[model samples]
Target: MDFLSTYKGGLLVISHDLPLLDESITSVLAVEHGTLEPFRGNYSYFLAERERRREQRIRERKHQDEKIARLEEGIRRFKGKTEKMAKRARSWETRVEKLKAQRTEISRRGRQVAVRFPQPPPSGRTPIKAQGLAKAFGQNVVFVDVDVDIDRGERMIIMGLNGAGKTTLLRILAGVEHADIGEVELGHQVSLGYYAQEHEQIRAGDSVLDHMRTVSALPDRELRSILGHFLLADKVDQDAGTLSGGEKTKLALAQVAVGAHNVLLLDEPTNNLDPQAKEALLDALEQYEGTLILVSHDTDFVEELAPDRAILMPDGATAYFDESMLDLVALA
Candidate 1:
């Protein structure tokens, strides 16, 4: 609702994007029974209040059960004209209304206890064949004819100077942009997820919780836990439009952890992250036992992540290496 409410230009006030929410929202709304209440708190408050409400419901159910048992006795022993049954029914009905309200509130509050990502069917290791790939803008040839094979579980890196068409090749492989010539054939059961530096996969105006619920089919607890890992636990109630670049990148990466896939296509995946975050990510990548295709400017990270294999491009030609990219460039 806050997203639909706009001011001037196209500036968004609130969002469900985890990263964006952490950067924005200052308040929260809570509902109890049929009454609506607003909360001026952040992520911590939201979780605590939700827990309080859950506890409240549990107590309410206990009270209702006892009341129902007592009321049944009265109904059996006393006549309807005495107003005992009517009174008990009214009281119980009101309690039932409150319990129902709690249930509704739980669902409406955007609490996903589970956070599962989509697991595209494994693209097993056979071999990805790229034959005669080429692209050009008018006469300014971006890349000339090229053929390559990506073996199973291959940790590959496309290395080239700026404007050498590394991004163009990645885009073609990711199916985001096409090539003017040649075809990329994947091995059997090849699953892929790409993380672009610009974060184009995320929509605008989504909150942290909202974003989790959008992509995840998990419960609120799980969602919060995952957001916590990305430093958004205290800011989940915040709007997404307010997050920093680093926070946004963390949030985007968190989405990938929901489900397991085969190939990870990363384009400068460490753009805005701090040194600590970058190292943590590198640790994860090192431990990851899957195929990776990374495009990065971090010389150290690239060397660490895609060592012993590099594809260097110059003009309309590409040179393959079974060693360090820096070594090849140094020789050049």
Candidate 2:
């Protein structure tokens, strides 16, 4: 945000950071219904103006609809009554046609996924424990001597800038990648659900419905219903590899929802999700009773989750979540 604020050039920024949007952006180019509408101001101003335009368009549509209704009624009453009445009705029909041609389209808001995680079975007091965990790729050391413990039903967030080993640490904990020097231990009866930022858990050539079936034993009818909630019902037969970024994210989350895992390791889960989908995910997380370890750059999401503790990356330092760390969360 600091760099963008100072640079005097046209910068196309795509971000969910409210602070950055309110402070740094001079204008907003909102893409809706396959068209770009430019608003000249900060984020707040753009929201207000957009709302005003939508309301105005809605009113116009209502008035036009009423006029069309009345015209149709006249056409029905006058047709076949008399030659003069029929001629007048034909004129009214022509007027209705012209009105319909000139009618303004009222934009509809985008649909959001209604996500709900299955109730996870009870687990031990400590869901996960990492001791002296360290990882490196060749000469680049990601983190070392890291120690962290996730208590039952606790929400923890990992904060760090890019390349600061946040994703690497999550992968290690998820058992997708190994730590060079230490280990992650799961408590008794603890099941893990991992959401990879790159969607690595989803296999190529597999249909979206097939992927859901692999993680869940729900009947086909029930599974299809859950997929419908995530807007994946129509894409059930589509190959997972061919999905768009947002579709893939939704599919991955759908898998997580049906897994009934007591511990969730989410790495940048909000990526590729639109604002509405993000809100839905946040609401679902708020109601979740299982332990959570999240790696995300969305400050609003982090604040709303109200993580009990934070794991600072690379150094592997641990600290309680506080307002002061919000800036670092943005950087992450």
Candidate 3:
């Protein structure tokens, strides 16, 4: 961040990192309703100015609506009088239609994204346990002699510096990647839902609706409603490959929501999410009854999750979570 902020070069950055934008960029091109709303300053300025503009538009819209209502009332009174009055009423009706057409279009992007995870069936006391785990690529050892015992309803976070094998260990526990030497055991009636950092579950050729159908056998109407909750209602027929990074992340989480799994393994799940979407996700996860295993660098999200324990990686040491652990999260 420091380097980018001080660099003397022309750069065009597309990112969801607010701090990075505030520090490194002097301008913002906000995409709202398929239109670019350009701002001359940084992210903070954009937010403040955007809200001011929205308020102004709301006031203007209210005034226009009131004028239309008055004109409509006049038309109602003039309709059944003399022929001249009736003609004037018709003219007023024409003006009202024009006014309606000219009314401002306040963007619907501010609508809150609703992400809710239905309560999943209960699992045994110990949802997952791993023993003697180790992994390596050729001569590069990621981690070794790792062990983890995750309770059914506990929220656990994996913390480490970059390349400290946090993501690798999570993949191993989720059973998507194999540990060179280890045994992973699942407790009774445990169903796992893994949200990968790269959105690997969503296929490129499939449409948004198609991806949902793959995760669940629910009716098309129900599946579409679920997508709508994540603010993907209008994009149901659109190809998933064409979606932005944030949209793909939402779709991936949407799949997890429909899986009805009692255990969730989320790898950097907060990546690519804007502030509002992140807040919605946090709320849903907080209400979920399932066990959670997470890998994230966002300290605010970690604090909100309030995990029961943390597994520091590479050496694979385990400890009860505390405020001291947050410092390590930033280094990640």
Each prediction's whole-model lDDT (CA): 0.66, 0.90, 0.91
Global fold similarity of model 2 (TM-score): 0.90
Error of 2 at 268 (Å): 1.5
- Tens digits of lDDT, candidate 2, 94-156: 999999999989767876789898779979999899899988899998888999898999999
Model 3 agreement with the true structure over 177-221: per-residue lDDT tens digits? 999998899899999999998888888888999999998999999
* Model 3's TM-score against the true structure: 0.88
TM, every model: 0.58, 0.90, 0.88
Candidate 2 ranges beyond 4 A from true positions: 13-20
Considering only N, C-alpha and C atoms within 3 Å, which residue pairs clash in candidate 3? none
Scanning candidate 3 in windows of ten residues, the lowest lDDT window is 104-113
Could you give the candidate ranking by lDDT, starting with the highest?
3, 2, 1
lDDT of 3 at 280: 98
What is the TM-score ranking, best to worst? Answer: 2, 3, 1
Candidate 2 structure lDDT: 0.90
Clashing pairs in 2: none
